[model samples]
Target: MTDHGPTREELPFPDYDHLPITGLAHRIRSLDLAQLRVVIEYEEAHARRVPALQVLQTRASELEAGAEPSGGDPSALAPELSPAPSAGSSVSPATAPGPDIPPTESDEAKPPMRG
Candidate 1:
């Protein structure tokens, strides 16, 4: 929790903590070994999530094996965070049921009260 290094806001993936595990896999493809290391350290200091660590370690391995950093934009909006077309809520007045009405006190059809 102490000042380990670059703050979460200063890391390659500034929104790392908020990002989903699946999204993280794609986003990390753009980070170089050094940037990825910083993120790994930050993750260990904070959440230390196993899945995230796995993804990061896998990328590090790839980098060590001569795999180049992906050409995708690291600063691009995460697919998970992007607004999906026609993804709004389906609820509307047309789908809602009509309001219920209470019975009047003078109604003759009222049933007798239970004991």
Candidate 2:
């Protein structure tokens, strides 16, 4: 296949090389078979990362066997990957409350733990 200059940056995850194996599998759930093939070809041609290629190949097989894409929306993240939250009422951790701040007490007024 003539690569014609398609780069890793053209992938759904431009940082695909940086993704952990588990993360790669997770992100691949958002891809259709065609998109998956683009990645597999890219990996074979340029980076040639064996582990990643295996994952892509496995997933592509599953797709060929009639498994459906998670229907994950591939537009909500990574500027290219768009995995939408599966539920309407999903509360992302980004929207969750942070740690509670302890009330400030005057240093002199605080009782010491020592005897």
Candidate 3:
């Protein structure tokens, strides 16, 4: 709790960079004031994610104003990534080869020089 060097991954919120506003709203309800403050500062320095930041700041204020932390069900949260398309919606690599496409084994496919 007192550790000062918290990173985005270390935050209680999963996928902090990508959590939806709704998910953030639900998750932050369980964090104590100190935790909420850390989230706010992390968001500000990283993406400056306004919606999540506003939600967290507001909750932190509520706690400062004497509200108690209401622990929420962390397991119920869903990932921000959308569900993958079912089988037919995607093209299999084995079936999609084109004559113009270079072979993956060729030296020409090597990555460009970075230096």
Candidate maximizing TM-score = 1
Could you tell me every candidate's TM-score relative to the true structure? 0.67, 0.57, 0.59
Ranking by lDDT: 1, 2, 3
Candidate 3 TM-score versus the reference: 0.59
Per-residue lDDT tens digits of candidate 3, residues 1-115? Answer: 3354468666876566666788777777878888787788787777777777788888988999999888675434566556556766456777786669555776677887798
Candidate models: Cα lDDT each: 0.83, 0.76, 0.73
Q: 12-90 in candidate 2: lDDT tens per residue? A: 6666765666668878998999888888888887777788889999999999999988867543455444455686765
Per-residue lDDT of 104 in model 3: 71
| Clashes per candidate, residues 3 or more apart or on different chains | 0, 4, 0
lDDT of 3 at 21: 82
| Higher-lDDT candidate of 2 and 3 | 2
Residue 54, candidate 2: C-alpha displacement in angstroms: 1.0
C-alpha-based local distance difference test score of model 1 = 0.83
Model 1: lDDT of residue 72:
84
